[model samples]
Target: MEKKLSFRNSSFLLLFFLCAAGNVGAQVNPADVRYLGKMEGYWTMKTKLGIYAEKWKRVDEHSWKGRTMRIEGNDSTKMDDMRLFLEGDAIYFSIVAVKDSVGEPVRYKLRVLKAVGFVAENLQGFYPQKIIYRWKDETHMDAHFEGKQGKTTREIILQYTRR
Candidate 1:
């Protein structure tokens, strides 16, 4: 009797899991996974600011994603935390601008200041920054960075193309 009851319980658990899986919406599909996969590659960058190229790599399966960007020539200066979440067809991202200093990382959170024509944002902190990006293609992008450092406020426009 115990053996029979155990088999029945196992069958019920299997059926419940199958039904639960079917009901969960927004579960990433094969094409979504494919698009996510395609994001991993080298990207060429052109900007009025100073820094040149940015390399992107898909370092996660879902939920939390990470990428690293290093300035050309100088290996010392690098920006980390290019993280984003996927919702429908749009990708939402937040990156902390950490100076290449030898000490602890300085954190900055980018928030949406406006999204009228193209999405734009004023970063949250004492030293605030604004960032805007528009999709050039399915795999290409262009962005603008503007911020205040110390007593100076500066702006830069940059292009990013996936390779």
Candidate 2:
């Protein structure tokens, strides 16, 4: 009878520890999830030259998927497919352009520098060495790209409104 009591006590302690560990591992930041969900919608930007549209959707708890297109009059050109995911301790943005022949995605590590924005830098010695996404408000965002084209430096900013 003593041996049976000892076994039961050990089993109960083990189960208690396991449940505690599971709760610790399952804890997720609500702010991070809310930041990702904010992008899920249709956004449009219009310039004198053309119009650009982006669509974003939450894929799961840790990821958001997006597509972008450019329109000029009746012609529409697909720009790229993009994904944002929380990996390890950092957020990552991956892009695959429609005209890319390498057949591989380019990934950027997004580091949140402020309360309402994040910056992604190119680690692959590619054009667009830096990309910044900043929310102007709940309904507006500005995306800025800075890079080099040949010997000249180019910077472009696109302002987007939720559609």
Candidate 3:
């Protein structure tokens, strides 16, 4: 049979659990919250696909400038330029072909669906329906893209580090 907890014992156990969970009267200063936004900056990543780089800067209190570059293959046979904007509660990341040619960057738009410090969830207009961003730390993050459309499911993982 389960033993019933005494009133005092139950109260003590509840207090203990709250303390152990680190949720006792926690506080976050507004200044500290704003400080989290400082993470905006340029970052680069070395990858088997290419040298992928991005720049993020605050354009205003509620907007940001985002730029991306990709140099593909050892010979740098392919390059792309992408520029985007992040407004309060949303993002508009778009890919643009820097040069007109076959296999040029296809212009497309991406939107932010969710976000937290250093972490963001985005959806591209193309096949991929979901994107995840996980910050390894203040200077690094990992991104995962996954999608399934028309019998095709593609996924790409990328790492980004502060430049």
Candidate 4:
């Protein structure tokens, strides 16, 4: 037996997923990503690995680019090249390591959008399945990374302040 969805039925499925995700629209909107502008500038946090910083630059109305680096004595080592961009009415957060590979970045789709924060998720990854960012105020922000790895569920929270 063979089955096919009629145009009306297909449209219904699309609407279903869009409503379930609660992301406002299935059609991408530049305005939806405008909140990212609040993150522009440099911020730092102290971690067991040492000091880390994130710098953001608004590339356009639809995107923002960032650098995540580890501070050393006087120089910093770039850990990742990150981007938040909109495509087809949806927002995506992507990160690629600062290595020669230049392979595909790990990407997460915006699943929840709110006034001060948003939740992005990658269903295919074994670890870091979710990345959450929130602006606590003009000078502070929180970043949360969570996922299941090797039979353990892990979540790391980092609080950064303007530097």
By TM-score, who's the top model here? Answer: 4
> lDDT order of candidates, best first?
4, 2, 3, 1
lDDT of 2: 0.66
Which runs in model 4 stand beyond 4 Å of their true positions? Answer: 1-30, 98-103
lDDT digits (tens) for residues 1-163 of candidate 1: 0011122474445434433443453232323333444345666664334344555566556434445454545453455555545545444445655432444333322222121112323344333355454444566654555578778876555556876
- What value does the lDDT take at residue 22 in candidate 1? 32
1-163 per-residue lDDT for model 4 (tens digits): 0112233574445434433554553343457677788779999987666788899999988889999888866888987788988887679888774122345677788876555667787767646788778777889876777778778877777678987
TM-score of each: 0.45, 0.71, 0.49, 0.75
Which should have the higher TM-score, number 2 or number 4?
4
The whole-model C-alpha lDDT of candidate 1 against the native structure comes to: 0.45
Across residues 13-120, which tens digit of lDDT does each residue of candidate 3 receive? 543443333233333222333433544787777766667776666656544556666766654332334443443433443345322246553332232221232212
Candidate 2 lands at a TM-score of 0.71
Query: How does candidate 4 fare on TM-score?
Result: 0.75
The better candidate by lDDT, 2 or 3, is 2
Error of 4 at 86 (Å): 0.4
Question: How would you encode candidate 2's per-residue C-alpha lDDT over 1-163 as one tens digit per residue?
Answer: 0011122474435434433433354333335645666678888888766889888999988899999888899998888888888877767777775122476666666644344655665635466666667666788876666678578877767678998
Better of 1 and 4 by TM-score: 4
